[model samples]
Target: MDLEKPQADRQRDPEVREPEGCLVVAIRLPVRIIALVVVLPVRMLWDALVVVGRIVRDTVLRPFGRALAWLGKALFVWPLVALWRWVLVPVGRALGWLVKWLVVVPAVWLYRHVLTPAGHATAWVARGIRAALTWIYERLLTPVGHGFRWLTRYLVVVPVVWVYRWVLAPAGRAVAWTVYWTGRVLFVLPVLAVWRWILVPTGRVLAVVGREVWTALGHAWRVTGHLSLAVGRFLGTLFRWVFVEPVRWVYRTVLTPVGHAVRDAVLRPVTEAGRAVGRATRRALTSVRESVRQARYDVRRMLFGEPRERVAMARREPAGGETRTLEKRVRREVSPPTRG
Candidate 1:
């Protein structure tokens, strides 16, 4: 009885819920009616606005835009294009051809015929004048100049030179010889004679006396030289023992150490400083060189842009079958048609 009651309640549950569902429906029916009544007129108005906009665009705007375009093309663009292509281009070409044929041709022909011949004629006249001048120089002026030269040379120069060589030279030589001989005879011979006779004997006696005195002096000098040599040897030995050896010893012991100390203290440091300065200068110069190289590279990049290697790739040719097909097409295109 309980199982039957539960099954019966499940079957009757939907029947019992129908009135609540109908009440909810009854509640939503007026709202749906009010929404439909409001939205239908709004939709109709939107559709009417859309239809009007489409009609305005299709009927007025599209045709007007197309008409404006056509009018612009006809009025401005087409006329200018036609003027350039048909009128201006053809006129310019015709003017160019006319200038070439009329102006340039006539100018060239006139130059070739008249101006060149006139220039040649003028050159021929100039050459004739030059020939006339050359003939005058050769026949008249040159011979006259030569005659004058020969006359001057033979008449004036030869006579003067001959007179100087023969007459003047001989007279001058004779006068010189006479003066020389006169001086020799008057003064030199007597002096020579006096020297030979009196002065020579006197000088000979004086020379003998002087020779004896010289011999004595020479012997005395030899003795003095030997005594002075011995004294000099003693003085030299005394000087060496007293001064030179001590000075040498002092130099070896005291001056040498002092000099070495001074050198180490002053000169070595100075030398090392000089070497360091030189190394620093070399490094600076190397850095400057690198900077300059970089600047040069930058300048080159700025001027010519980066270096690019261009490789030329060979074009791939058509295969044999393709080539044959293309050739057949070309042959068919090029060949004349036959009558069927």
Candidate 2:
């Protein structure tokens, strides 16, 4: 009965076999699809983000790392550096001496000996300055001083004045007159001849031109007189029509009660309306100024606080839930109610 029961159970269970390899593969297919579609891409992106973040962090921290390395090297590796420096000191000195011999020493000698006092342009400039100063003193100062001294001696001193009046003064005047006469005789004859020859013809032409100009001017004066008379008559008629009649009409008509009515109704209301608009605009500007002051105070408070992150969060997060709650709290804290 046990054997029969086992056989019956096996028959009932249909041999009790496991699934085939194809079934296992089919079952894993969706999982593989999910991995390829969702998991693999997410993992790859996560890894890429991690790598990018690492690169960014390294880029940002590289300078600090280099600074720390340099400091460490400076602090701990100084003895090796000192040894190298000591070993190179003689070489450095030799190099420096070579450079001095090659470039600096010759340059200094050339400057000192050839480019200083006896340089070509320098010596020439110095000589020119000295000559100019000497010439100025001799030509300008000495002559001025001698003339003033001679004037003082002749004008103020009694013996010098007597010698000048009797001897030097007359001789100077006679010599000056002779030289002046000689210059006059040399220059005046030719000048007078040229003046008479050229100027006589020029004067004749000028006289003819003057007479023509006078005749034209007389005709122009007659035309101008006639034009002025016509202009005066026209202006008289225009003045009678424009100024006098308009004044008379205004005095007669516009000073009446209807004019007063028009003035009171139209002009006065327009003036009052203009004044009211001006006052309203001024009040609006005053309110805007007060609002700006409050805004500036709020801006100052926000700036002194952590504004960048808050502003970024506010821009990113919509005004709902936690954001609205926070905004309400911030508004309440930043702007209290008026105590009216």
Candidate 3:
């Protein structure tokens, strides 16, 4: 509004002026048309040409490289490979044939010529040996074997016969005498004693008494037995009823039940306690086993590491190199040892 003129010309211009004394100036312009007409298509074409060039190069070079490689293989590699195959295959075959000739062929030949003949000879010799063996078996070994068998039989059978004659014969006579004596003592002598002392007198007395009693009770005498038989039966029945039956009944009733009850009450608890102790012992043993396993593992880790180092050190050291500490001593005895 004052003295400054209006910058209408500068405002109408497109480019802006640089500052005073500045060497360079920047401007903004619409280059969209230029980029659209020239730069974009040219860049696209350049990229396409680069790609096409790479494709064409690869396509042209691939077959040439293959052909060149094939030619090189045909010229150099194939001949050398063929030559190597020709040399090595025949050499290997020749080596195999030589080995066969040296080892297998000779072995086969020896088997055919020497070993076959030897085997035939050996067969004949084996026949002769069998004959000789049969002769030996018949002449020497059979006799020895028979003699040994006879000796064994004689040793056993003769001793058994001797025992039968010497021991069993006397023992049988003694046993017969003992049996006769025992029978006499148990039955004949006792029967004789009863007849002499008790039975005759008792029969006579019973007869007299039975006569008197029959006179008194004549009807009862017909119901009773003979005097001796009646007296003996009465005594036997009294002994059996009074002594044997009472003892047997007491044993069966009282002793057996008491023994069974005592066994069930006392021994059964003891047996169960023993089984519990056994089970506890087994558990303790298993725990000890586990502890032992852990201890062994720890001991192994402590003592057995660095085995190679120990072996190396041992190899460096001399064996049995220590000096002896004790003087020698000797004792002499004259008698033969006694054994139990």
Give me the candidate number with maximum TM-score: 1
lDDT of each: 0.79, 0.73, 0.71
lDDT of 2 by residue, 1-340 (tens): 0112265676788667444345333444343333344444344455557767899779877877899999989987886688668867878999999999999999999989888856888789999999999999999999999999999887789787788889998899999999999988999887998889998878866665564455444444444445555655787799999999998888778777678898999999999999999999999999999999989989998879645554444465555565556777688899968998
Clashes of 3: 0
- Which ranges of candidate 1 are over 4 A from the true structure? 1-225, 310-340
- For residues 199-258, could you state the per-residue lDDT of candidate 1 as single tens digits? 998987666556445544444444444555565578779999999999999999999999
lDDT accuracy of residue 48 in candidate 1: 56
Error of 3 at 251 (Å): 1.9
Q: Where does candidate 2 stray beyond 4 Å? A: 1-158, 220-340
Residue 32 in candidate 2 has what lDDT?
A: 37
Model 2 C-alpha RMSD to native:
55.9
Give the 10-residue window scoring lowest on summed lDDT in candidate 3: 21-30
Ranked by lDDT, the better of candidates 1 and 3 is: 1
Error of 3 at 241 (Å): 2.1
How far residue 172's Cα lies from its native spot in candidate 1, in Å, is 65
Q: Which pairs of residues collide in model 1?
A: none
- Stretch of 10 with least lDDT, candidate 2: 1-10
